[model samples]
Target chain A: MTSARSNNTRLLTVFTILSVLFMIGWWQETDVSIVRADESDIGFRVNPVIPTNQEEKNASWFRLNLKSGDTQPLQMNVTNTLKKDITMKCVPTVAVTNPIGQVLYNQMTPKRDDTLQMDFTKIGPRPFTFKIPAGKTMVVTQVIKVPKTNFNGAVFGGFVFYSNDVNAAHQQSASSSKRGVSMFNQYQIVVATVLNINKAAEVTPDLRIDRVTPMAYRGNPAVTAQFHNTKPAVIEGQQMSFNARVYYRGGKKVLFRNVTNQMNFAPNSTIDYVISWGNTRMQPGNYTLRTKVTTGGAGPSWNLVKNFTITGNQADKLNKGTKRADYSWLIIFLIIAGLMLVAILIAWVYRAGKRSSVKNAGH
Target chain B: MKKSWSTALSVAALALVAAPVFGNVASVQAAGPKSGDAALSGVGYANTNGASGWPAAGVEPQTASGTSVAGIGFVAGDLTLNQVPVFDFGVHNIGSSETFSMQPVDSAFRPQKLSGNPITADTKANAGVRALVVTDSRAQMTQTAGYQVILQFSPLQSAKVNDSGQFLDAKGSATTDPTKFTYNTGTDNKPVTMSGASLQFSSASVNPSTDWNAFIGDSLDFGDKAAIYPAIYTNSGKSGPVPAGSMYTTQTRLAAKDAPAAVGTSIDEGKAQVIYRANMKTGFGTWAYDFTAPSSVTMKIPSANQQTGTWVSQLTWVLVDDPTQDHANPIISQLEQ
Candidate 1:
């Protein structure tokens, strides 16, 4: 009975220790600060040409459904509250996925991407110009004609409004014997317009995971997967989870592990998704990378396990970049404490057994 | 005893293995699914480049002028009026002198008898206007005291012309037939003898007791009136008040010598708007002492025999900004302010 009682006490002690350790691990504080983007500097605002309804005053983007050879006229209103008259110009641009897995509107100027088939000029208002008097409003219109040929998926572009005042001021200064460069504040307001042509055509979501590269993301060294959303259909609401484990060419021990989630790809674009690896050094060796992605709703899930070698020079170059991560020291301490508790359990068993035999002999 | 210890060890091991799973669960929750119409609208900056033409010179002061196009970049400095106010005193009996006064039309304050809707420079999209906007992007504007906006008009003129444009006569000689009437010039196609037409302005009759609405820095007292004198440019190209419809340029800067009654003031900043009450004038063609006679902007034919034909005049507005220190090209200072 006494042995059983001592055994219960010992077990209780072990459980109590385990609970305390777990509580300590959960109690550690994590530093996080979230700041929203600022919008005070934006000079002007853009709305869809046709308002969805009177209740919803300004629609942000155009969602058009059309067939081949269909012609639609797009109209929008621009207002200038500045004291001076403002001349506005419009241009076409495409959406590009940046390294951080976010969609960014690229202003098409000097260079045009070849993969983009939608022509902004064919839609009528490539370089539209209008002047809005101070505290006045001006309305502009553009007509779009879809090609007769059948095409699936969505074509994305934007009517980017730029100002001419800066250029005019620059010209005036250059001709009028001014010694210093005339500084001009310039801006662009982009109204995204998406055209979905032909319901009969196929709009597939074709994604290709090219390679896993190491790069710096937001001042942190991260492992990124370079991929392309080749299809015209935009892939959104994606619940993607990537697990990257680093190990030697023929070793069982993993040197580092990285995981990332909630990644999306823009329509007909290429992107790089950075994996979060907390404070792990890049070592020179052969490595095997595994990734698993499950998209939202009736979509196919991906599991790819691949091997890639990291040369000495590559590791050295990557190590020089800035990497931000938090090392969990509490985890290490808990792990060591667990081991010690296991050793104590073994010792308690031996002592209990000895005590039990001695008690039986005395009885 | 051994079994219990084994169970406890297993539980601890499971917990050790599940630590990473907790992080994964948090991430999954944070990245909730989002689909359908992948459209996004955000505030973006616009920058374009082009040249705009100035308004064309008019044939006569009373004639409608062409649209004046001004280009504004990110930082804009200008003083603009929504539109000009026209006072039309309809036809009256002959040999009788009629008098009228003019006051501003604002939503907050309404005139007892306004002829028609005041002309606004802005289109239908934006129809509200209260004060002038004066922008200064230079770094020095912040260090110095703010600027003021003054308004002055030329004396009633028989007729005149300037390099900027032409001015129509305030009154013309009478004609036997109204249908054959001509403005400024006579129906005989010649300059008519002056009918001794006259225009007098009283200081702006602002309600000093009325709290400042939009004007930022200027101090005004209750029932305060800003003086408006008959200052006109002479026929020989000098600044002076003339007998007939003379030439007077409302000084763009309120601080200039012959300041017009200040309608607004702008402080040293991006959007510092000062508001003032619209001026009031009596039916006798003089600035009203108060709002007693149903203050209305009236035009009077003082001499019934003056003109059987229609007479016209013009008011031109100039809006420009330059850094005080930049004298070489006062018009075109740095674009980015």
Candidate 2:
């Protein structure tokens, strides 16, 4: 009896320890090294053309300083280790700020912006194409002839190289027609070339708040303010501070109060800055969100106010049917506890029967 | 007896509970799909009958017994293209046949040091071999072997000129016409005739110094004197000068036919470059070719065939999978590996 009881206790103890360890494992985050099965074997590299006296080695991009109307000759030393020969088509493209707040230079067909006076297609080299022998290096040249008239600030553009093998690349981009089994991995890389025209120019940078959006960011409710730099000059050393408040229809009761500061902007770029609200339950109601932004110590400032209404149906849609998994540990623990209760009940019944049998033997 | 029964029941219960605590949690979801791939559908059960009664979100006892078949497929790996050289051959004396070297040069056509091209070639004795980089990751999977890479070049074709019927000259000056430039669109039977000036191609020795053996680590075999095969493909028995639109293949030492690459090993067969000399006829028009000519091969051009304005042609390089008979099964056999 004693040995059996001790065995049960030991078994229960080991199981309890195991359950705890399993729970901890489930709770902790795991980092798994996932190797992509669809990654392409084709690769290419763009090496910056550094002049004889320059110090940058194997730099990823190029920065050129030139006077207006000054013609500069630029060359890219390209190497192709691909097994097949490639007809590399080169085009000059302009960089613009995307909605996601990052600078994009690889837009195939970019819309013309009035603020960007210097045209990339005009000053850049004619579209050049050359064959790179497999495992051979070929040099492609582009001569940028700045307009004769003097201009200020910078002209942002990039020389884009593309592999004209659409058929082969397309084959690698899609897998067998099976429904769940699809794989694609052909991507293009762009080298950003920033041409800083002349050394010095005096210009004013314009800042404007483009839009404000309410959405979930990183699993938290937040408001993102999208802003843009309209001028060709880069906005440097500028500081921004804003106060955001939400009030009821008549501006009587305040519901949300947020204050943000020290937001900076890139040159000719747009950024979406998010301010998070921690798990605040929002109800359908009229609200007023007002913000005031100040730039630099004594430079400039802007005020923005917007009145909006949140519909009940929209709030219901945003919060209504979202579902999350229950904690695995909690469910497992409850199941274990219920099993333990049944085991205890069984033991009690067994003990009671044993006592009754012993008493009957005494009679 | 009663105590033993109770203890046995408790132990059985515990055993039953512990079975699924660690069954297959490691394979919960196959992570998210990468960009440009298939989007994620609704949640899938690793071991469940989805067709009969799919498990809803937060549904208990969601698993069912079924054989899951995860399929594996092939995609071309990302290869690196680095250090492409700009071939800017300046003006040529119309009557004289000028030979240009495909070596890295400054704006003045003088040899210069590039990122990948070292300075030892300045003396023209150890001239820097122009090379491109191609990295393959297909062999990364356990079932895959190395791939066979192939390269082909298109003939020099006509490019667009400005509306004024003028194109940029070598110095970016608008002093040329697109109509004046014509390539040697010759066949094996009917090669272009040059009266006085002729275009020529000269083959420079393949650079054997590149560290091709080290890129693939121990994954690939280059032993037994296996060597890269560099040749210009032509219908004329690959003889004389390589006609326009011919293919030039640089020799790459492959895995020895005797041995196969082990499974799950990726190999990079280092750099391979084919260098050639270009001797032109009717000197004004620019022509591009990978023509791996013999040391002193020349094609003559008659002055009557020459036009005054500058004419430019383009060279196109294309890298594709080697479709040769020997490489039909470029991947080493899995069983052999």
Candidate 3:
């Protein structure tokens, strides 16, 4: 009876400890989850401090109509939610279209269209890098002075806010020992500031095919067609289709084709639509590019054809630079191996015949 | 009599210990955010069901085996990015001379129950699945132009630095500089890198059919628009006799007009790939790009450039307003009205 009681006591102790540990671990896990969730929320948010002349009361961005030579202070509330003070960089950039036909405002000092008379970066104050206190909202003010020369369309630009705290997190992650494609995310918030000098109806949309060239796109050989929206009116709210085809100058066969549907273009921005070569080697010859753009409505449409030539040197350089697998050495090795096997077989046959002849002679 | 007493004491002790654990779980469940709680607004919660609307604002939680398995809240947003997956390629042997592929490990931020416990939630659970999610609640009173999420990456760099000012891999192997580590595109300089390394993602599904329906027309069923296979059918030009439960199915084509924006694309390191794009008429509410089974979200590593240490990279997700839309003119017209 004493031994049995001892065993029971031990069992109870062990079970109680395990249960307590399990509960502790569960509680710890919950605490960690809550802490992680809080960490994810430890960033800054931007709200446009709408001016008296702000057009849209509910819009998150700034939309104002200012006359030429009008000066106004554009302000945004940068609220840092973290416990520690954070530094943020404010980049004022002109809106430009990317290769994927989407307009981007985060690009700084992007090449401005030649027809863009009113540049937003020049009109707004220079880029500001300032610090915000913890749990405090800092009013980041930029004095916008419209150009004296009157322009017919709107000037699209934005103030892109990037937190240094996020970059510090990136640096910390980069310095850690974690391996194998570990990712650190950096967040950016763009507050678009649209300045309209004239009415939208007064401006007409014009698109021009600026240039075409053979270039390396995403590490692959591709031909980029630069679509430039010359006029300062946004070409949007309408479905547009772009069909680009490449061929040997007069040949009817299409060598490569890229048809992109439902694309929009920004006002006074250039979009470089890339046509992938699909691993085809660049050849030295005259090539023709035929591009057709159509909007379902009576909007602007174009069918343009351009002729260009690639030199032998250019083709050789491009083909060498492309990331395609080069199996020339493997092919040569396989061919040589086959020839050697044939030679070995012949030598063996010769030796066998000689041995048979010797044996027969002895018999 | 002594043996029976010992046994009873042991049982009592166990029951005493276990009762508290169950009690704690119950307390946590009771303390969870209630449905239609305005305090939980502007925050993102996991949506296990294909149901629409905010999870905290009166949306029903998913019940599994008569137990509530609702998603916990994480991250803040009005036009907010709720979750972005962390792709971890686990440990591997060094000096591999052949190409290999790795799938991302299960996410660290998997959906938790109301008791702050992790359940084996399937792909239906948005937070449990390893995916990317973005929620947009910016539209009010009037329709807003959509947004774009651009993905940009950098080459894999060493995550550690030794005392000698050299970058160290996970295995304590040191390189002179972190820049020496490169994501080899096959024809590059001689360095420690995973040759021809690339990341690809597919299998995209969006929530709140109302957002998609507003753009793709109400005739087609959104659930049937799975990314696995393109389902194309010619319009019969008439509402003929249809099978049961297939009333909403109509002439669905995989063209740009009949579908949402493309989400599946291979991302090259050091280049910006537009992973998700919502044009003028679509991409409202929340959308997730599921990287579950069958949907290939893989990291390809060639054996020739396999280094001994852990490699790290930066994935910067840039969310911006669509530049094509004129933000000023519309508001100006509203003011004129």
Candidate 4:
């Protein structure tokens, strides 16, 4: 009887252990879900630590006036609000203008404009990645060393900061491919930096028409005028207007016209202003492009004119596969009408001749 | 009686000694700041002020409660990007030329007022649509010269693999290069891609505070205090006349400065296209661009290029500073003079 009681006790003990293990596993699973739910709301904030030499006291961006060969340290504070640690990538890039005339600061590697005297990427901060601990703030510093030579105007650039952890997580989740189309979204923050050297230099903004070409824009036939801002100063603020017209060489009739207002230009940048030819087939001819520009309602203005030609081969290639107006039926009807009129005229002459011959025979 | 008197005497002495010690502790606590308390030191206040909240269907700012969608949260900055859309092109048959319309699934979060009161009892009425929302509070500090939002696209890649090994399921495995839209062109299988894969928008609306009605009235019709701005680009025959309270206004229309003829803009892969632009003295508070109609956003796949399996792409919404505003810098003008 004692032996039987011991065996029963052992079995009961094993059952209790198994039940405890199962509860522990279930709790762990629930805990993971809770952590993931909290992670969805995780975010961070970054702020520029302005130094004493900042030119604008109330400016949110970095505006500094420094001499040639001056060295300064630009600092920013990154604060992590979540309990888990996060990694961030910081990229310092030079500013470039987009096609629509907006100054873009987040391009990793942008094509340098032809008239760019000084490259900001060379003197600006070096790109780097750093980590911040959970619920802590970290200071990121980048040293800017100006060249020995003095330069005019301002060197425009910006620092782009984004969380590497969030990107990695999204990439991992997006790896599993599915049918159809899937989309992923990302967010980045940019802080503009303007470094000034020669404050006494003149700020003269000028614009010139580089070239005009006929090409396909967005898969549609169009004429594009390339406008080059050949100066170091930016054309901004004042309401700027652009009026472009295309015409046959030396002809008064205008073939195409594009008018745009309030557009701005970046320093030493080029913009391709497209004039679309909607539903019209490209024709081979000599065309003249005339462009007029006015800024700030009554500010500065320019009238530019250029002559360009389109070849037959170019027109044929551009018009290939494009729907055109069909004229085959009209041509066929004209040919048939001309033949019948000729036949009726011959019949009338023959009758006149026969009548004359019969009169002569009677005489 | 003697024992009770002795106990009272002892209690009185203990209270007298403990009072000064507690007072000293309180004074020390008052002198020192808490561990988490931070002091921001700079010449100007940091623009890192968090966004107020998401906007409701009525276009009023509403705070989110509980769990929210991924990448939907408060970003502490004067210029904040609140939300971007997740476009889903539903499953279709393989190797058949077809034009697919976007089946946009709205990921709406529960909205609550700043006072912690629920905006609507039924959250369904306040469901979000396929739109991009941005908020600019820099105007509060007299910093005008608004911002620009541009869209950049990456080529669609194969995101999933089938058990039959028909689709290559490698992560970020795109069938086309960054510049083109043709998918799986060089692969052993037939390639698939749409001719014109574009994201079209029907309207761009702005919801400003009621306090600025007088200033807004100068440009727009402010018959009712709760009027929204006019659509920047309205699809033909899709939108009606502006309502009684809400009048179409040009107060905040700054996109005209860039593309005077911006309607029906086309997008190319790996190229940045300026979708929305705000110029000087415009684009304040909450703004959204809606693309929720059937034909508003579309992609056409030729029957020959439709290879079976899922295709994927990425659309990056970038908010950038306008260079035109840089010319107005007080210091730069001072130097020019």
Task: For each candidate, report its DockQ versus the true two-chain complex.
Answer: 0.01, 0.01, 0.09, 0.10
Candidate 1, residues B204-275: lDDT per residue as tens digits? 434233111211113221123232211111111123331221112221211122111232121111111112
Comparison by TM-score, 1 against 2, better one: 1
Task: Name the candidate that leads on TM-score.
Answer: 4
Candidate 2 residue-wise lDDT, B137-210, digit = tens: 22222222222212111112322234554443344455323222233334663323322221222321222443
Please give the TM-score for the first chain of candidate 2: 0.57
Candidate 2 chain A: 10-residue stretch with minimal lDDT: A175-184
**The 10-residue segment with the lowest total lDDT in model 2 chain B:** B278-287
- Error (Å) of candidate 4 at residue B58 is 49
iRMS values for every prediction: 28.2, 28.5, 15.5, 14.2
Evaluated at residue A88, the lDDT of candidate 3 is 82
TM-score of chain A of 3: 0.73
- In lDDT terms, how accurate is model 1? 0.39
* Residue A72 lDDT in candidate 3: 86
What are the fnat scores of the candidates, in the order listed? 0.00, 0.01, 0.22, 0.23
lDDT: worst 10-residue window of model 1 chain A: A30-39
TM-score winner between 3 and 4, please give it.
4
What lDDT does each candidate get? 0.39, 0.39, 0.55, 0.53
Pairwise TM-score winner, candidates 1 and 3: 3
The model with the greater DockQ, 2 or 4, is 4
Model 3 pairs whose backbones collide: B36-B58, B98-B303, B170-B310
Model 3 lDDT, residue A171, Cα: 46
Please provide, for model 1 over A279-344, each residue's C-alpha lDDT reduced to its tens digit, 9 standing for 90 to 100: 465666766666565665676566666676667776666555424232447778888899999999
Rank by TM-score, descending? 4, 3, 1, 2
